[model samples]
Target: MRTALRRRLLPAAAVFLLAALPACSSSSSDSGSGSGSDAAKATESGWSFTDDLGKTVKLDKAPTRIAGVNDQIVPLMNYGLEPVASWGYSSIKDDARFDDLDTSGVKQVGTAYGEIDLEELAAQRPDVIVSEVYPTDEKGTIDESQPDYGFKDLDQQKQIEAIAPVITIKLGGDGADVVERTTEFAEALGADAKTVAEAKERYETASAALTKAAKDNPVTVTSLYADTDGVSVAKAEDDPALNLYAGLGVKFFEPKPKGYYWGNYSWENAGQIGGDMWLLQQAGYDTAQLKKQPTVADDAALAAGQVHPWVSAALDYVSQADYMEQLAGWITDTKPLDD
Candidate 1:
């Protein structure tokens, strides 16, 4: 009777041990699965973004020390992302493009064209660099040889990149598209969402008003930049300001063949590009000097004061809205030119 009892107890113990072995194996599998999930979350939370160049930039954490080109800085600021340092362009004072920006605490990395103070920029210890990338080919490749907004030329690009990751936004999109992309970039940098939303709302409202005004008073408009040497008639579709005007119902003057951004015309024949009104690119020439030119002075639109300021590179929505409002007011105030 004792031998039979021992045999039954031994079999029961073996069965219990087998059951415990499966439970331990299941626990190990669950632990491994949990570790993989944690790693995925860690990757998701890390700082990583794909720039316009299609390069993925990564950092240990979200960047705080940011730098940008002057033209790029104002838009970032409008979205509530302030930069620590900026290069390209000059002081915002008296510049219409930067009229809405405040650059009080930001350090100027470079003030002149094709010049960057690398020592000054490096001293800022920027976590990231922001700028506009202009495409050179149909494949949308950046022209590294050409000067970008943040750096004067490609010569200092490596040094700048060595300091921090460079994030570039493509510059050729329309006004609304640009605003959307800029908002996305700013949000990625931890800008206040509510503030960016408010700004976007304001822009849309202003844009609607301008469109209505433009529809009410339809007219032909042309954009030109003139100097003593020659005049460059802007390709309306290529320039942001002119594109906005075209979107608002104004008929743009298209040059013959219609591919290039600017059609170069001698000062003698500048007036031949006919339009009911003219939008002047107000750089490298003064108002008085422009008015003094025979071709510009003799043009019916110029003579009638139907000329408005056009910033080809205007980026910020507020600045674009302000410019559109001014254009709308001009359209409302002036009589359409006789055909």
Candidate 2:
């Protein structure tokens, strides 16, 4: 069974629109019937996409009035294709995913925990909606019942689809893959090549610098999430953020129990898994409260002020680059407490 913490940790939205959708509806299915001529015409006209679901979403022209989920909006903006509207797990101001973004112009269709404003979203009249898709099978079958990135709940999904074609890229891959796929989607939507190229260059530079810094400093890092229930250490192989950090040369503390993305621990046992630095997942919780947790306070890294913000869902290139720079700076600025 997937842990509740897994769902809570991700920025992706949940499905809550089952009552509104037909029992046997295929609204979000990839089996839309389109003629061969239509496919040829789409290729000639300029915009077409075979999403992760194998569904072909076509446009007469590149979409200018775009709508996206919170995590997706930032990347679209970075590629110079800002969405006209967006919905997210929190208000624009509160979501760290969009800290560097200027979302003043983009209309907020909904905020926090999959609550979407159908009327407002309809008002946007978007040509297409973009979001991240999670694959359910080895053959790339996506779970279409739920919208990704906290855009809409199950009941509101079909309603949102009625307003626009929902295009999605697969989620849960390496950070580099996420950047490449997101850029490809943006490019298809008419994002400026120069802007995308610049973002990619920035990411590459930051990643290289981070890798080099880790090599020189060699600090052991651990990623964790703490709540009232307990604390959990994230597995590097299972989490994209942790994997990215590991790829950049930071060594992570391995948990005793294997095969799961996160290992649950009581507050008292959190310090057993030692590290020179700790990355605390900061989503859906108060950082101040987290700092005050007995487990966190007891950890050597946390007590020594070696704790850093770990935005697990920062999939976009610009955010990833910024995070890389932050980690690199931390590595260079502080000496290992264990040393």
Candidate 3:
């Protein structure tokens, strides 16, 4: 699963919307008539759409044989694209939201993060592949300091396209906006208008609840990453993380360099990286060891307990809704009141 802040994480400008759309996109199996309005609708008709790479490929004319390579089952499920093949079943295994799936019928490939074995992916021959954006050092930037994982945002996705056209949706933001990304994919796949409308309505409902929750108590945002070396907080200024929070009008402790995941601050620079509320993404280790690290323990937010560990590890794919709910609660639940 990916982690992105709920607010302040969109591209500097609005992303371009796909051009064609049927009026009421719904998720339905094309019946025998195939000649009815279902087939007549121009927008929700095929999977041979342009990918993030801007290449046009036809995988499905309303793909029935779908493979979900990335971690975005909910949207595809909502879009009515059932996975004939998956990286693994772990993501849907635990969540109640995906009770509709039947794992016995689907092929289990592997994990979502690593490079796919082209031979294996080709063998499945899915009509469409949906993927999630890989985590970067920060938006539009790379973490040069960490060389082993250069951490390029779209690197793995570029390779997926060589197999088939793929749509990369950034996680982190008001969950509703993810539908827009879904719509783009649907247009590519010829998704039904009813599906797009339903997804949009779902997003609108979630956004409204978040808006009310913010009015009840504003949220503060933060991002964290932990590996064997230590924990580093993100100071992001764009897509998924910051953008999600911005959508809710929540505030977070701002970091230096203005735009990046929370910066790497040492003991000397710790004072500057503070926030009224803090959310952390802790590595799975003895909590005591994390508390000993100055970066994890000595920080002001950690001291006061205004910090909560945001959970993304349990999920197979992180969607906009997942990020919004996790971070929104992390921020709101930790709100500091005047004592």
Candidate 4:
């Protein structure tokens, strides 16, 4: 889930019409009838990408001065493409997902999603902006009328699109959705093929490991932002990684997305949420901190220490593999706390 500040702890991003996307892409899937965009193609004359909205973006040369949302930028960096500027939700600054990657020289134009220092982004002079698209409803529909997942709206999208072409990568069903699409885009942008290939190999291994662990364990999990006041449980349908994890046979607690991206519950009532295990934020909200909550002392998962950190990594095979590897360990080791 793209955590948002709807409550106090979670963070969300800015979206736009002509927006941004992620990096590290392989060959694009052949366009199905009515898919609305052509497959991304590169040639000596120029480069072109069919963005998430089915818009084909053409440029005279592959863009080097890349700038866009941090979620995507980090993956591009994994593939050896450095972005000039990046803006998005607060996750860029403090999330564990971006912990190891050094974003030293990259200009931060936005601290919160949708909020950006236009002048600061403009100062970087990016050649292209990349962002993502998300589903609007439960059925995984990518409505073009909805704003792209990195900028605020059509107005904000146009304001930035005036600076350069915006390439959007949609957050799709499985972990590989954005990773594969980003690989195609990154390759088009001249990312190293060897590095991308190696990353893909690691990803395949981790994915297999996760599948085996999940199939063997059969433990249901719940992912949430557990705060002092309440918990905001993530809706798997809204998170690309969780969707992938589910496909691998991880049984996530099915919560109706009643709020923005999750279902809300008070700390007093949090224990009522059912799951064999819990996927939680890594730091600050530790067992000690959670014990401060009313029901944490009695919660089965908490008592059993059946909690693991949640990771929404950069949509690249490298990062995805790392997270999946970690997740597989947790699943393989954890005993079910619930029936």
List candidate 2 stretches off by more than 4 Å: 1-42, 135-153, 284-296
Model 3 worst lDDT run, 10 consecutive residues: 6-15
**Candidate 3 residues 234-284, lDDT tens each?**
644443434555666666545564434445554444445556565555433
TM-score of 2: 0.82
The Cα error of candidate 4 at residue 314, in Å, is 1.9
Across 1-339, the per-residue lDDT of candidate 4 in tens digits comes to: 234432122242343322443232322324521121245555787767777666666766667889988778888888888889987667466755566777887888887767877667777877778887766656667766756776677777777776677787777566556577778788878889898899899999999999999999888889877665677787775677887778777889976537545787877667678787889855236767887777766788888888887765677888889988999999888888776
lDDT of 1 at 14: 14
lDDT per residue (tens digit) for residues 122-204 in model 2: 67767788766554433434566666645546656666776777776666546566666676677777778788778889989
1-339 per-residue lDDT for model 1 (tens digits): 111111110000111111111110001112221111231122555666666555556666777778877667777777777789886645456444556567776788776554667767777777778877654433444565664554645656755666666777776536466656666777777778798777767777777877887788777777776666777676667655566667767678776533335677777776677777777766646567777887767767877888877664446665566667777787776667748
Order of models, best lDDT first: 4, 2, 1, 3
Cα RMSD (angstroms) for every candidate in the order listed? 21.3, 5.8, 10.3, 5.7
lDDT of 4: 0.72
Model 3 regions lying over 4 Å from their true place:
1-47, 88-102, 132-179, 187-196, 227-230, 257-259, 267-272, 282-287, 294-300, 311-319, 322-332, 337-339
Q: Clash pairs of candidate 2?
A: 13-150, 16-154, 16-155, 17-154, 17-155, 89-112
Tell me each candidate's TM-score: 0.81, 0.82, 0.63, 0.82
- lDDT for model 3 comes to 0.47
